[model samples]
Target chain A: MSEIPSKWKCAVIQLHSKPMQLEDNFNRAQGFIRKAAEAGARLAVLPEYSLTSWVPDDPGFADAHVDREYLSKFCELAKECNINIVPGTFVERHVDDGKDMLYNVAHFISNEGKILGSYTKKNLWHTERAHLEAAGNNPHTVMDTPLGKVGLLICWDLAFPEAFRALIIQGAKIIIIPSFWNLLDLTEPAFQRNPRSEAIYLESIVISRAFENVSCIAFANVGGQKESGFAGLSQIAMPLMGDIARAEGAHEQMVIGEVDMEVLQDAEESYKVREDISRPDFHYPVYAKN
Target chain B: MSEIPSKWKCAVIQLHSKPMQLEDNFNRAQGFIRKAAEAGARLAVLPEYSLTSWVPDDPGFADAHVDREYLSKFCELAKECNINIVPGTFVERHVDDGKDMLYNVAHFISNEGKILGSYTKKNLWHTERAHLEAAGNNPHTVMDTPLGKVGLLICWDLAFPEAFRALIIQGAKIIIIPSFWNLLDLTEPAFQRNPRSEAIYLESIVISRAFENVSCIAFANVGGQKESGFAGLSQIAMPLMGDIARAEGAHEQMVIGEVDMEVLQDAEESYKVREDISRPDFHYPVYAKN
Candidate 1:
């Protein structure tokens, strides 16, 4: 295992992708990655479905052929920029028991252009349930990297604390969530009380997850207007400092922040969350049978 | 089971208790309960350690003899005010096997003065772990009440999402937390960045829990100056409205809000979080063997 850096910078690229325009989306993402790398970021993460822009109904959107080429481009970019990359998610088509199925997948690439790990989004959003198959019963994806153990979760998985808990328990020091959440996710009644309800949920949960797990959280979300329903609040949050850097609004931007192991170590000494969870006598009941 | 009201008011009584002044604290808590009931609140909650304050080193603070009488007084107040009560927590000294042990415990009392259920705080704070025994391996306490299936958690337990998950999985619609969180809980380095880090944690986690679980979270915290470390941000939050009512600062006051079942039902329909969790194929890894 390589020695982990004690201090480094990370960036979340909040991109506004053109729906179904793969070339335009890739070009924009590449530009953001270059900017992040130039700004001294060792890791840069993009929003979920950045390549396809979340247009599930578009013709040939789920084609498996496009995914491999798109990932190869991201790998080449990682090597060229000399930065680790989490290039959002792409739809994956696989055959299981003679039936074709689609899954949303994300990959981690090293600066040397190695595919470190690949994770299929386990908890699908309500709408995605209709078109995508989740990787149920699979363990959370936690990969050992030069930055320390890193884990990945997709948009809707943010709502489930269990996913975060599973990763942290596996010794993940940094958890990255690539999200495509929007303001209009909530219903009409909820919007009446607070039009920014979804935004509040995204920000609060991201900060809370960092604090509670005593880990760093990099949340990258898409950018657009309220009418476009893109609730952009991309941020890099730490346990004690909350959001060290956050996007100002629903706009295409790169939010960067320092990820210091010292701060996390101090937080652990103060809170001892991981220590408590590791105690042999510690237990919390789980009602789920499977 | 009794008929649960579709819409009802709940109050979080944020009190500043005098150390070891049980009588004065009881009187103040009773006054707040009467005021809440008069304001049409069907349920009222108090902060943890409200009766004896948080002086753990005080002599006779954990006496078993005083707890029963203190709880009886709360039951009497509940019947007199015609409101359900969660009168914070008390240090309970119980005989286990051949030894005596101390556990931090909370209870739910009906308007009829019946002790519906009792919950021993399972997740003890780092400091408390030295003196208090946690109720490890015990299932979370959720009881059927006129307000619906209600659950209880105390103080530091708020940091552990597993406690909330256990109760919600058992069908808890309303989760009440009695907290004694303080602004000075974070280390010096953390405070240098933001002195309000603990406050942010309390508020964000409360709102996030309500949103993610699609349940009502009523949080009652103590009030005091920053010098005293009290980070009072008592709130009543629901699925749709993040915080229907909240205390403005570290001050003694009662925050009341309406818990509408219709709004929760609408959120459930829109988010379908509960539906997804209930799916047979839903699974997330748990590394803990116990």
Candidate 2:
């Protein structure tokens, strides 16, 4: 047995996924995987709704919008790259909706290209609730990888701490979020069609979750703009008691980094704030409605 | 009356005050006021504890440490510049250690250099419970100003929506807050601290107070450090359907802005969100305690 443990390297790609362009989006995904593997990344994550746009009504496009063939090709790419991949959010025809309506899904594939598992976003965004069906799953689960155990939570799922906590309880060392965050929604509201002041709200949740969990968080997002207008900002953050890294804003290209399991290991020792500070057992009655 | 009524420009100076060095702190504040007056600001505010640090048991410190001679100097300055000044905080000397050990106070002085009224911080921070004593007072009472009816709250007081609502109920068109926020302490270890991963708990209170009340908010904060490393970030945020302007990072300077009473003359008519969405009576309970 080795005295020193090995470190795990993960890559995050922030891209502007062209809406409804399944072929182009798949190709982009394949390219990022190849580059990450070539650069020695053991795993890589993509943004939520990367298979298509978070744009309204695109999931219900023509009959040829999303299919198994598209996913099969992507799976082949993951196998060829020999690295774990989180192909962010995509639309899958729901059984209850008679395949007429779809559910927002996250696909996790192993380096050997075997389907690990999938998670559907539990708390659908107000905009999403307008079109998508809320999934019945718990939305928190950990996958056993060669480097470490990882958890998966989609875009809007960041707002719910309980979901991420559930995954951590299942022994997740790092949390991966695939997001298609539209920038026009927050910063450039004056010029966008639909302006949103929810950036503070979303950013608060992301930051608080990292601090509360004492784990590294990597979020890959769709950035840049479309011919139709709308953009995104991707970020990676760590609320560390010992080692914290937070980087936000537009990163429309491939970005790579290591999850640094050592950070999590050291966090176990340095979390002074978490030691008997928040009395959740007592605050439960108070915070339940909030 | 002229076609264009006389305008009132306000400046909220967010200062980072130290636990010691009273002379230097006052001089730095004077510098900001001079600059604001030169830029045509008629009214300005300072943050809570701008006179002294929030910690207890520092040498030569008392709960009520309001020095009358120094206040006279401020009155002289306001009179010289023909400006209105809000005294952020002071150590008001008191008779009862239990009743008024320390006061989180705000002094609204008119342009004519007359003391209007003072609003002590009603909602004390967690640390305040141990370091200082809370003062009992009317939650909200509007002050008649030459410009309009103005309302006030100290740092922790802003967290209570009812305080702002009480001000609005009395027909306050403008709200001012003098804050002394220590960003470093806001980390998890401090119960008074919000998670620093993002700026939610702090930013949300300021943003919500402005949006819900339909009144302009001018927030001044104490900045810089003295003996310790406490810091501050302050700004003057306008009342819009969403956030108007925000200042991030350590702000030891003055933030000035103008708000046209006409903008809120028919606020319910202009902002469709406030007109259609807001229900003050149905406000969900905020600020729950364990």
Candidate 3:
């Protein structure tokens, strides 16, 4: 086995944003990221819809949504703390649509105050879709940083395998997901239980993403309830295995972990995860293509 | 509401199998399908690799595989039992290979012992890639029978939404997945904690499939270990729900349940599972399509 590299500690900032309180949510997020940095975490991830949540259909949210100024403020904080921060989703103003589009976004800010690329949530949750306009284009892109190739995605995107596969194809060694996941009952209760905790399905997708792509996945979800019954439960998963570090119960909290790129090497050597074990011969098409 | 179709009982036959043992396995599967039919089931589905598991390492599997004779027996059984049977998969004697190439296949048989159409497994599992040959060009085909436009796929195909979408495009109102699901630790533990004693992941897939396609899904899994540590645990899941009838414990067994085709219409109309709620605008592309 190859020698393991110096491990990088990551803090998953799981918290509860009392909807529409921009200042309060920012303070809470700032506090958690600061603690993670103090604990020697090289990077930290915040939850989805954290920037300007309380803004519902009411105009209050329109006034409260996070803007360039808010992101710049957070960038200044990242510089001050010398911690790489993965700021969760924020309602931002789009260039094309002057109207505020709820961008389930993630910002990668370096400890040295360098602003990395931001990832707008590719797949929006149902509620978010109602309020936010879909990102028409802008495919999954990776940011090359000291911490290896980092891929970013927002909440509901994790449910789809193809989205994550796109990130992996872009040479992302670590995939970060910022989420605002809600638990709810489906159409039929007689058919299934555990409606409130779709965590298992989420975990499976993350695990498969990591395993197939051979990349580390860091998922940071906020804890606590908003006007809508969204319970926060942030988690970080290593490549090939799901849920490396997870916070239990719905509480305002943050989870910290490390992404050792060398682990990918080890898992590959041990498990042959990338080996095309899929039977392409049996794939659909009906007739053999020469 | 359009005059509701008469309530039809559908059985999802989970078929866990040993690597080879074509004759014995075929006989066992026949018995279960017959039992399900006798119990008033109008449709029955078997699991992937039911005819012959793709474990290429098994010594007896290569030569002792089932052929025309075995299928002839199944045809006879379907006729005698007077049931609609979907044989999960079988290793067929390749017309050209002569030696015996594994074809992950599904056979649709009528109550009158007539062979309806057959759909080969499209997406083979990763593990099978090591031993089993890839099946080229299998398209999503639907069987227009009494149980609605029944779409059929093997195990891995479910992972790819496009495959099921093709079936839906082809007018498949219901999908039957005959699978040999390799159980992990979490599945058994989750089942142990549940009243129905079924894996949460299995239920998740069934519900997700039903929701995404707006069709009823009846998935049959193999039970009964041949060489592997665990095998049998058959179940039947309805649209937008979970397993209504399932087997218990870790042992091999047959399970049966009824799926009301009307549930699809109900889920689509009042529940509006896939259409009303599912917002594909937020979709992420996983694979790089050519």
* Winner on TM-score (2 vs 3): 3
Listed for every candidate in order, the interface RMSD values in angstroms are 3.4, 9.2, 9.3
Q: Choose the strongest candidate by DockQ.
A: 1
TM for candidate 1 is 0.95
Interface quality of candidate 1 as DockQ: 0.52
lDDT of 1 by residue, A1-290 (tens): 46789999999999886687788889999998999899989999998888778878887788933549989999999999999999998898999889998999888999878889988998888788899998886778589886889999999888888888778877889998888998886667767766777887887999999999999999999876757788899999888788888999888888889888778888888888888776656585222212
List model 3 lDDT by residue over A1-290, tens digit each.
13323588888887686777777888888888888889988888888777665345867664454446667778898889878887787776555646545555577887777777887765555556677766646767778765777888887676555566566555677888887765552334422433443444454445555554567888777677443444555776654344568777667887777666665765555334344322253233211111
Root mean square deviation (Cα) for candidate 3: 6.3
Report the C-alpha lDDT of model 1 over B102-139, residue by residue, as the tens digit: 88888999998889998998888877878888888677
Best by lDDT: 1
- Candidate 2 chain B lowest-lDDT run of ten: B281-290
CAPRI band of model 3?
incorrect
- State the lDDT of candidate 3 residue by residue for B115-165, as single tens digits: 778877656665666656655554566777655577777776655555775
Model 2, A234: alpha-carbon shift in Å? 2.3
lDDT score, residue A85, model 3?
Answer: 82
